[model samples]
Target: MKALRISAMALLGALLALTSFFVGMGVGVRQVPVPKAIPAATPTPVPTPETGVDFSVFWEAWGILEREFYGEIPPAEERMYSAIRGVISSLGDPYTSFLDPKQASVARQDITGSFEGIGAIVDMKEGKLVIVEVIEGQPAEKAGLKSGDIILKVDDKPIENMTLLEAVLLIRGPKGTPVKLTVYREGLEEPFEVTIIRQRIEIPTLSYKMLDGKIAYIKLREFNEIASEKLKEALRELIPQKPVGIILDLRGNPGGLLSVAVEVASQFVDKSPILIERTKSGQEKLFKAVPGGLATDPSIPLVVLVNGASASASEIVAGAIRDHGRGILLGEKTFGKGSVQQPFTLKDGSELRVTTARWFTPSGTAIHGKGLTPDIEVKAGEGEKDVQLEKAVEYILGLRREGKSDVCEGCGKQP
Candidate 1:
């Protein structure tokens, strides 16, 4: 991993999936988007006696556990929360789950783009906590954390069986304080230790660099609240340079707010019905791009880089670009997460993200389990070289186009 020493101001952050790596839902994908397009779904009505369900069995078990348990009983609140999680889990939809107040707070703060903690994104894979993305020049990179490194311990404490939120809280601390991570890298003989000093980290919505030939390359991390404002700032600076082409990198982005998705995409696409949404009741709505976009000229060269991790809001942007024929997508297949989530604040300051609808491309393709197929399918391996990016540069520079279809056919969708 290339070490980056970030100079931007930091915050006290306990990095989760999208915010907290950030949250696991619209509350952050890696949507970490609240509603910018569709209205938030109304909270589910409380269970009424008319509903045919038995609570006697649940009460009986609870009573028995309280009376005859072998060990000390958990607090009533924890037990109630666990029951709620169990009920939610029974629905079998991974995206629809509950978060307690603390997790909810982290999810909300992530959109602000400022936080404190080691600057890294992590997720659970096969029950192991693994580092996914390390921000350039962040404490995690400075302390030598790498993508795919498995975190076995934090502060010498085993993280086994802890939830993602629990682990993140344990790893996070006050700024300038040190948190020790015991990591197991692939080629290492034994787990090693790395100590990272926490800082106030303000995660950038996007970072841009001008490539050779004045091609503007932007790497967008998430569609947080400040995303549009930041992108406008970046575009204002880059567009004045009259760049020949643009490359948008959304490789590991997990997605954020849906409204923000449309807003960010508006910069590139000017047409209506950038996306479609379908509720379980069959009602449908077509979302259009808002007015006053920064870069709506389709003639400008553009390529979006996506991988399996590019999901939700990111997918919405990529799909819109393809369906509108505004740009071509490069790299691997995207993470197919087309369902729409609505955030409902519970009474306890906790949050519940429930899947309310499924979204589609303007062309009417529903990418739930099946991701969008890139126009140029190029896969890369871990190394010093980025083959997909190189290919994009070649495409923009007119270097390689021998019998390949770079343009989308019959893809323009009208509302």
Candidate 2:
């Protein structure tokens, strides 16, 4: 019996040796197959009364968890997270996501002027990992990352099939961490590699310049900490010039920090409701502009410039001004992103950025996907002088010549 056992062990050892020899010669191990592209399908809209769930998978997952998990398993909230991910994945919209606490916290910090990263806004456009916007003073901006740069790889990993959020997760890391980005730029001959050190980026929220002598052009990049204060500083410096009009540009801006947006919007609107939140329980919360919140020269004719990139807080400010008849919106339609995201922190130091509520303009117009249209439609191409701003200035000057006052006729206020 001992001899038979010895013989079996010897045979197994021989087999292992033979397998190792063949593997060293590159003959035994199977090569990993390259992944093929899966075309994106159009998302079927989930019906209203939005539990926003797929019950079959949810039940199956729950059953599996209840049966297989060791110890006490997890709480209901954790189970719901798995269910929510399954539901959101079913929608097939890569951009629309259900972030758990960890992911939510990260996303919130990304917007809140915290966290260290390459500092590029990326989104899945036509199934490609594309750069939406590069934050000024970020490592990406310093590396000459452009607005339409397609990200092909992170470090050495091919990101062709990865979603934007996933790519961001892979790219973002601790401060001073190095990341190599392989990007395909439009005018570049070949794909290039950029090695960047991650750092905290304070997104530029306000850009100002004296335009054509009589107009101050302030391009709001995004709503962030001290955005209102910065804007006020710009106004303070510009008002002395006694500009005929103020052109507030919101082109190519993805909104951020709702409170800042509200403060900025209040600078244009008088004592009136700027936005209203409609909750799931049919409750409405009104965000009204406080009295004496307008700029010192609120009656100084104003024009807001918007385009396809203008979204969220940008829409809030634009919508408020338009609804209040306080300013004329002059660019193309704004990027209508009106839903509010709430960030929940997780034990793993991650976050979930969940869309909690939808917001509407004072006139009850929801600007989610269907963006705000300009009062004076002015089409302008890239690297071109925004004709919208020009038209707005023309309109304001025309009104001034016609002896029409700058006050809101509908609101009967000075702003």
Candidate 3:
């Protein structure tokens, strides 16, 4: 089954399944346009409960505004959009949101990973806009945009009350245009401004190299459609060298398609349940690993690296590897985001992304709002080298020296 899994920023935080593109770093597959508008179905009115509550007041206000409002009132369709936004906002779910026709069109481009923007992933946290990931070789990275920088303004406009999508709209523009951003960084008393030239960004999926001449180190930037295939190709090239172990780095990865996550986990796990999905009605569905994975051999020692930015599909893969004892998890706690969202197109060509279910690890641990904790907690210092990666490499080399095969008791065991 093709499950729709997403995080916050389509290319950044949450996942939008339309084109399965990366948000923050700007990577993904081909784009697919939103479906054509369908005819509106007849409404089936429900009888009001006997609780004595009346919704007639809403209609009365609408009628009064239509009759006596001084300024030019918006079209009925435009007003309907506001009404829908109000209703969805009442749910108090940041993930469940409405995208208007224009926004919906941009979302399609976002998931496909090609757009005119600074190429940085960002999200709203506690009313503040925060950078999640900066795409390598992109304008954001070239401008020295770093993860964790809190955005204070866009184009000199205060972003205090703007939604993440609002700020995104302001930040992105025609290619070669400049967008100015003011951000607050830790240890700095005052905020600073940075001008970035927007350009067409194409995000790369994975990067790998052999470490210590024996261990294969693969860094998965995002879980896009081609992630698993790229990983398989990387393994094909690395396995011939007979590496002692493998380190899968998932730091700063937001999330993407659910099906892609399953494919990624299958590469490391053999014939085991990867994750379980629980719907609102309490129906449970199991996602198991498929046969013929590139790295399913239990004898190969494995390690996974994660951080606060690793979420959704990334968490699924990390949680499976840890729960099945196939590898060791090392890094900071993951970004807790476990809910699933499905998109429903409206008659106006807009879209509604609604949260429908929650996902659990193989051991039945709920990941929604509660991120996974790594077995070995390693922190990376600010402006310092990647200490966590170095630690993973050290651990894997030690296992190789000990002549260990399959799994190490201190790290993980074979399933």
Candidate 4:
């Protein structure tokens, strides 16, 4: 019942829908920050009287497979891990998932915002692993990987039936290792292979620049550990420039740490209870804005950009901004992913990521599967004209002259 470390709505962003384990939501097709400091609790066996479920049938099937199956058996650990996955999957919740030690390690490192993999964001579309977004200047782009490229195989092995985690494991390797990807381009009739040398990718948590109108343009890519730190750095550099307004872009952000989300929201929303966490039992908790915020000034005027993929911690920040009227929520409705995940590490270092709670905006609107609606909806896609951004800029420039707009009914309400 305690506040979870990974996210109140974090790790389930990417992997649950088969798009989560890429090494690039800050890094990986992402979800869930593994709270490393959490001591691994020893596994407790459920008493037969507690559940009253038959266990003999599982053993009987295992014995049959071991005795009569023609193929060699995997290690007992693999079988056990697979069973754990089955147990979690039976819950019928995509966010509730299990990761082996290696996958768990990758997820933990994702919080640090760097990992060893071909840099790209991938999604499972129609049962095929497709390359959605490749990190620029990284191995994926360097190897001529393009968006919409369908990956058929990794290192000559077809990725058929492999989970996103499994496929990501194949694509990820130690730095300097080579990974061969058989790709099927939309225009190309034949599937071709591209060998990429995996390297240490420093996922950019954010990038900020002073726009032409002297506005601060900050694009947040993830809520990794260093996100707030990087934002502080950006503020120190940009605030002095005296920008007319700020544009905090959260498009394509897949979410990360829950604590980091609160910290990021604190930068703009100078109010208590930046977010709310509600367990299934209807118990509620609050995450308040912390002190020492660098951008809590009400006159600065803010606008946030979000799209369908803006999830978890992304929705947290966007929701806070809208609830407090700290910014105009522009772009389409956000990726509705307001559920919190608690990562439980086992003795063998595997992790069980369970959906433990649901989170809401400061105003108490649920975000899970029902994304935040934009105050001003503008649709835009990647590589196209950024009409949303242009609209945001125009709106902010107008706000500077007209003063605070009643963008939200709860605008400036200390609710």
Q: Which numbered prediction scores highest in lDDT against the true structure?
A: 3
For every model shown, the clashing-pair count is 35, 10, 15, 13
- Model 4 lDDT, residue 64, Cα: 95
True-structure Cα RMSD, model 3? 4.2
Off by over 4 Å in 4: 1-47, 381-384, 403-415
lDDT of 3 by residue, 275-307 (tens): 888889999988878777888776788989988
Estimate, for each residue in 363-384, the C-alpha lDDT of model 4 and write its tens digit: 8887776788887889885576
Model 4 — which ten-residue stretch has the worst lDDT? 8-17
lDDT of 3 at 282: 99
lDDT by residue for model 2 (1-415), tens: 0000000000000000000000000000111222232343333444335666554564566778799988897787787666557777786533345556544444444333345577665555565666656665668779898878887888988878654455566677677888898989998799999888887655555779887647778987655455678888888798788877778887765665566667788877774687887766788978778555635355678778888767677777888888777777777887666666443434444343344567788888988668888777789756757566677677777767786645544432212
RMSD of each: 6.8, 18.0, 4.2, 4.6
State each model's CA lDDT, in order: 0.71, 0.60, 0.73, 0.72
TM-score of predicted model 4?
A: 0.87
Worst 10 residues of 3 by lDDT: 24-33
Per-candidate TM-scores read 0.85, 0.71, 0.87, 0.87
